[model samples]
Target: MTTLNLPVVVSARTKWIQLFLGLVCMASISSPQYVWTLLTRPLAEKMGVGLAELQVTFSLLIILQTFFSPFQGKLIDRFGPRRLIAIGTLLSGLSWVLASQVTNLTGLYLAYGCLGGLGTGIVYVGVVGLMVRWFPQQRGLAAGAVAAGYGMGAILTTFPVANSLAAYGLEHTLWLFGAIFSLVGLLASQGLKAPLDEVTEPASRFVAQSSRQYRSGEMLRQPLFWLMFAMMAMMSTSGLMVTSQMAIFARDFGIADVVVFGMAALPLALTLDRFTNGLTRPLFGFISDRYGREKTMFIAFALEGCAMTLWLMSRDNAVLFVLLSGVVFFGWGEIFSLFPSTLTDTFGSRHATANYGWLYMSQGIGSILGGPLAALMYQYTGGWHLVFGCAIALDFITAGLALWVLQPWRRRFMQQQA
Candidate 1:
């Protein structure tokens, strides 16, 4: 039997260029999510709100970014990545710009939370979708690379933004960086275009992928898809807790302001977390490509559980706190790579963008659980220990699900498809 394939209309080099452009677009919009912690304190003070209340802004950002991604992904699939991503970057930047001028909490929510969420959501889903299509055989690595852009993109701004927040104040910093983010992302997105055709490669000897394409609605109905969604939601909660609450917990641990290796512990840890977080995506993705998605997920998720346990234990030590923060993120950030790749492998690429969008909404569910709800839990409990403990439990549980449940289920699913 012969396989019917879409003709390869673009050169191999063209896809690489497309990947690079997607990465750049991703990087340009990274600051909103990754650098959000740095703005939390100032924003809280400015709006005269409590930590739990201010965290609603973060929740809104994540909720809109993820909850609405299905629509955004569909738009990208219909209109192409270039225009939508360009608009998204501009909206993302404009969120900060408008946020800087706002005087009330509601305005902040609308500007920074809603607009920013919608914008970043578009670019994120669009880029990941584009990368998976462009590099079907190498989906894990490609998705990881662009996801790394989102995770690590703030590395370039973490220190600079910190210094700016200190030197120029929140208004000027937000305005300047907002403009920069918009211009850079817009320029980068101009070069992005989805692959017009598929180029099939020899099937991997290790990993099994679906030969038939499933549309978004059909994929959504599968028990296997819901299982992946539940798994992703747990992982997202574990990771987003660290991401959104690290600063608060660091301060509570009495290490936020402590100097560790010359820099403040909080910023230092944040910077290192960015690096490890960004590094883990492509690293684990590369491994997943050769080994298997569930195996890589198990290893990485277990590592995160161990790292979080260590991090909680070392909370009192500034040096260890800074170091272990990176380890914690290293374990958590690979979800972006593994989930989308696995989704595409199971569902096929015809509707990969929209299908992944449905899966990505799990992150929104996670953001709610991990962001404001975790903060509320901390408020109710009077400490972060309970919050951290719950997150640790989730990490191990999801890891177990991946290895024990998902692996076998996916194997059988692919077999039935065959």
Candidate 2:
């Protein structure tokens, strides 16, 4: 098979620079999904929609972002990151800009849900695939760092966005930030490209167990891939349920306006959650690098499960709520890093982007089950306990799967492939 070799030299320094560029691009596009919670109440009020109705936008964003990734991944492989990401950056920013002017649910859905989802999907899948190839020896770390940009990027904007929504109104804040994100993301995209063919060598810790490069179709035939997909869907559902609905629940619980460390608890929790979420990717990725991916998954996934339970038990205590929310994110955000790195390790980097795209679609399934469905559950139940209960159950199941099912299954599959 002939690899498409990069024309220019990519030194270690250059690779790091490429990763940084991807990081910045990912960070710039993060708020549309991550900060959706902050915008939920405002958008609902403005459009005269219910919480479950406003959440459709959130679900659409994840659905488009994850479901279309295989096509986006193929585009990245064909056209390269620079051009594709540029288009994505433009669309992402444009989504918010159009959203700022929307007067109804349909307009908001088109702007934030469809366009924003497509754009972020391109940037996300492209950057992750790029990282796996770029840092063959440190795939986990590379994936984690870029994923951290997405996971934690909202930290830089949370307070400012909350303040802007208060002082400048949602429309002005959306327009201003949208313009800035578009500019920054485009600039960052210019620095991205596929790694040199030579750098695509496999360097996973369990290198002796590696299989031949699998195309997207070949990958889909593997039972292991489906297992991972199921596990991803479960974890994604649990995490996204909290992520998309945190602010609403906090408000309903009467803790949203409570002061925590001189800032409103909701934004404060969000800021802290972003930090821990970002921190966990690299930290757990590094751990997975040495200790193994499934082990790390079991630990972190279980941590989230426990954190969610504790957070609910202590819902009335504002301070505990804020702290535990951070823990929950810390445990959950590593999924972005772990899943891609593991998929690339199992299937090989030849089709890393496209292969992971299929696995990533699990998030779309998860968004439906977790985002809108969870919201709907709350609407009917008139309480969040059912939603939290479902998430908690899935978390423990995924944690167990990571250890018992995923680990042994991967070992056996790779041994057979070898």
Candidate 3:
């Protein structure tokens, strides 16, 4: 493999500044997914649609966001991050602006689902790909920090969005925040630039990483990549089920309207979940940096399973329900950090953006199973018990895969590269 000998050096301060800008950009686009739950009830009432039908929008958003990532990542890789990300932020904000005026389901899907998905997808894969290259020595920490922005950004918006929905009505609220998201994201994206190959740090010895770069096509042919994809799919299903269905299930559990800790249970739980979800990415990523990726995956996945079990058992108690939701998210959100970091470690950073983009399509598969499909399951089963049970099972199964399958396979793969 040939290496570049670029003359321009990216200073340490410049790299950190890039990371900060990436985080801000990620945060700016987060509400389209994380804040969707707050809009569901109103959207449903306005459109006169069933929950299952409404959730297809969520599925579409995720499907488009993930399914097209390879193409989007390639564009970012070739054209650089600034212009594409700026355009992405604009489209994301415009989705909401357009969604505010839509009268029917198809229009809603096009505006909020297609446009929002495409826009956020660009920013997400672009920022993550940038982080892995810029911080090869701290892939976990850097990726997690930016991923945390996506997860936790909602913390800053959840309550305000909830309040806006209550005060201004859904349409006006969408317009207001949509404009804000666009402007903020556009400004943040202006500062983002890919690191020059010569300035990037080599992989740290503390973590296992491939010595040679593998193109996306080569990565796709590897059984190891497929195994990781399956694990990520299962984990994504478990987490996204909660993400897209939490409000519905909370209501079914009779806790959505219940006041706990002097606040409405649902919004409070959502707020707390955002915080933990955001915190866990960097926290677990940092751990994986030293202890190993597979080990951290086992621990976090198992924690989510345990938390889900407890959450199901204690559903009737509003206080426990709120607290447990946070725990569940804490265990689930680190996938964004761990998987990308692990993939770069295994595949090499030269093709990191496009390779990880291919891997990210797993989230789209998860969204199909977790979003509309899970909603339909609830409709058929007439309760959330079976739905929650299935998610718990997937959680444990994925946890097992992390230790028994991924750990060994990844070790061998790295040894061969060595």
Candidate 4:
């Protein structure tokens, strides 16, 4: 491409920057997961730790997301996302380097749990918020696209990072990861900043607060918001719980035969799962655009709830596989995109990122508790029956909460107020 004048480079970059930024942001966020598989055995053996001790990193990671999301959101409002993401990415690289030297669990916690988690919160907010701004017309799709990048990061880095580990060992692998983090982060961040006009415009001065411009704080006060939160949390409780334990669940329930049945198609199915999730967000967003964003959210919430309900009752691998696939593909897909768009419905365009940021933070809280809750239920009952049973209970509860949000009642209230 021929270089344009000074203004043109900036203009060209702004329009296309989200794609680049999204990729890097996702790469850094996904590193922890690869660490989950490749590093698990070596790190545990070297550090003399158990599975539970190592697993604390996951809970702590989600907990940090809860703490840092609002702060990152605020930073996006205060300073443009460029600096926040760049700095966060750099920190993550350094954390990996530091993690490489750690001989104890405490050091691992500081390196991966604290630094990795905080850095991701910063970078993820920036990339995702950038997508929201670029694709205001398709909130679900945009959400899904950003999420898909994040989820897929491991796939991209897994092989390459693993190759490095195979040659260098775990200690050296951490340093190599740090180097990748620093270089990719710095390079990727070059495209991250918004145009100056967007940066200079103060967010609050532009807020159209005539009841529609919803502030995150004010959103918390709305009964509708709580209901929406419940829907996401409840549905996610099952979807994520299953996701956290999919391989083990598959083994326990005789999933090998069913998965083997799809062996020829499994790779395609995984791609389909990711693509369907990514595409569903945008497709659902288009649906919301035509029908009504709130109603779209309600429907998505109900679908997700039902998916969990089905999973909870199924014993056959065939049924389990289908429901699990659908839940992640469409069930969570629906909510992932639906919630942000609904924020626009309730709050209008002004505070979509900030408002939605707080809403998504609810997921972090639910994620932390969901795993242990499911595990405890299994410990006592020795199967997924009780855990999935709780999912069914929450399914209706969340659906009811969703109905209160942008459904008939919320609609009636808005009409009367209007």
Candidate 5:
């Protein structure tokens, strides 16, 4: 009997596959979180809904994460990241076209919230999990590289998106975005595939306990689980705060152009952060593997929290001077890989995919909370000062929490930790 093969190759060409995966994640994240404001007003005006009501479209997409992410994780594990990514990219295109055809909030929710949201979740899990496996020793750098691609998507597409808005109008612009997203994403997502070794039989409470398999659920019972989770979430929340409000905050702080703020923030932040954050992943992961996950996490988190607090307090002036992002980019760049490194170190190698899935979820959670929280403060209190103050407070509290939990978690998981 003859059997068909996948025609896949592992070569120099395969690097593009990883690059595509990064872009797919970039485009997926950019649409729902970063670019919403650009679309929100026009869509609201077109649909005759209030801004907040239109904003519900954003809320629903995020809210759906609770439902979609797990299933996406399942699909990613089953079919490999490449197939799911292609399908998701196509679906995302269709969602845009459907959204452009809609005239009401319900339609918007159905297209953007239901379809596009889930598609993104699927593509994200498979691509990201694949990236980790591809660069096993370089997880943090890999994570940052992929994440920075995501960060740059909005900027890369900004021109086409704007040009479409001018030429096509609101409804047609959605259609244009849909088509463009699919093409670019499809091109980028080309090389995404899970390693053959990733398949596993479902098991409980067993930690995969080694690099051979990493199970986050099993790790949850370990003390290091909560510590790393909290550490990542805290640092993520601060970055999301910066992500969520930098443009508006820049304008409020006397910058003439909010657009410039939007354009500059991600590149500047990601440029430095991705390198440091990525390099830290393996370094810290190796450290935790040798010493302990908890100690490394405690140190990493402490430095991150301190940097975040100091940056936040200095933000008004530096940010007011348009140098605030530089300050933030410096302090806030270390957490991405360290967070996962901590998790992988504590849980052992078996659970990297599952645990990292959970780790990635923190950014999603932070994205949801950070954006509106900053906006709400501005709405209620009438200033960006409160937003800055609140961010500072959160970072300080996060530092204390990191210091308190990590050492103890380390002590308990000392032997099994990476």
Candidate 6:
């Protein structure tokens, strides 16, 4: 394989540099999905669509980012990181540039939805896959660090994007930022290469627990993969629902414009949520590294479920709502780190990218249900209570599955393979 022939740079410091490069690449692509909420209202008005209809663009972006990830992952494995990620960076930037000129729904969907989705998917899966191989001793933390980039990268740009949209025309803002995203992302991607074997072969739970390397086909055949898929899909549904719908819900609840500490409540909540979301990945991933994956997952998932319930109860209180949203994200965002690390632990790292690609499809399934479907639920039910209730239910159910079912099943599956 390419990994074997790649020059084995034995220095541990170089691998950390690779991890940072991957982080930057991930950050470059994150705004497409993470900041989509900011564009929803203006885009809806400009395109003459309802909130639900406008959300379809968000759904498509996620669907393409996740659904096509397996192929993108496999390609990264074949072609190496630098080439593929550079292409993804350029495509992501171009998507926004193309989006700047669009006057209709079809054009918006094509540029922002299809192109943006594919581009971000490529960078996301590719960088994540690279991290797993590069830091074999700390797979969970490595994954979490890069995933944190995606979760929090928008923090630097959220206010800027919001301000630019208001101050300049949306088209001008999109074009200017798109150019920067493309240039910066491509430059970061150039620093990425497959890790040498010396860097990738450190002893870890991922290597310790797995009985054998499983190919993508074999991984698909295992019942364990499907169970993880279901759990991930459920988790993704709850998190994505909150992520895509939060701005709308805040507005509807009449707290979006309410200010605390001289800042609008909704944006402040979003900023806090981004912080918690980024923090949780490495926090919980480090916990899982020491305490076992299932235990950490159980705790975090239950926290999200309870946090959602509290958020709904305090809906009218802007301060509580803002605080609780951060709590909810703190509980939810770690799945990006946890699930991928868990999957590699079970299946081994030879096909890590491809295996994760299949697992990532659950996120796409979730984006469909969580983004547009959740919005539709609000439209039909005349309130967000029902939507929040459904998400809470899924959260608890998945938490139960993670603790009671996944732990035992994976243990047995690995034993049998051994």
Q: Where is model 1 poorest over a 10-residue stretch in terms of lDDT?
A: 196-205
- Please give the clash total of every predicted structure, in order: 0, 0, 0, 4, 17, 0
Most accurate candidate by lDDT: 3
User: By TM-score, is 1 or 2 better?
Assistant: 1
Off by over 4 Å in 6: 1-9, 197-200, 205-208
Model 3, position 144: C-alpha lDDT score: 98
The per-model lDDT (C-alpha) reads 0.92, 0.90, 0.93, 0.63, 0.58, 0.88
What ranges in model 2 sit over 4 Å off? 1-10, 200-202, 205-211
Task: Give me the overall lDDT of model 1.
Answer: 0.92
**Against the correct fold, how does model 6 do in TM-score?**
0.96
Over the stretch 1-418, how does candidate 2's per-residue lDDT look in tens digits? 8977655545789889988999999998999988888898888889998888888998999999999999999989998889999999899999999999999999999999999999999999999998888887788899999999998888999888989999999899999999999999999999888875655343655433355889899889989999999999999999988888998899999999999999889888999999999999988888888888899999999999999999999999999999999999998999988988888888888889888889999999999999989988898999999999999999999999999999988988878887
TM-score of each candidate structure, all chains considered together: 0.97, 0.96, 0.97, 0.77, 0.74, 0.96
TM-score of predicted structure 1: 0.97
On a 0 to 1 TM-score scale, where does candidate 5 land against the true structure?
A: 0.74
Query: Ten-residue segment with the worst summed lDDT in candidate 5?
Result: 200-209
* Residue lDDT tens for model 1, 101-198: 99888999999999999999999999999898888778899999999999999999999999999999999999999999999999999988876655
- Candidate 5 on 1-418: residue-level lDDT in tens? 9977643434545554665566555555455544555576578678886544565676566545434665676666766666777877777667788998988889999998778776666665555566655554445455545654544456555555656776878887888778777777777667665655533322212122243344655665655566566656666667666555554555465542333445544333433333343344445544544554445556654555555556555544533334444445434544554565445545544445556666666666665666566566677888766666656566666656655766554545554444
- Quickly count the clashes in candidate 2: 0
lDDT of 6 by residue, 1-418 (tens): 3545554544778878998999898889888888888998888888888988788888899999999999999998899889999999999999999999999988999999999999999998888888877766788889999999999988888899999999997898889889989999999999899865444454574334574788899989988899999999999999888889999899999999999778999889888988899889888888888788898899999999999999999899999989999999999999999999899889987778878888999999999999989988988999988899889999999999999999988888878877
How does model 4 score by TM-score? Answer: 0.77
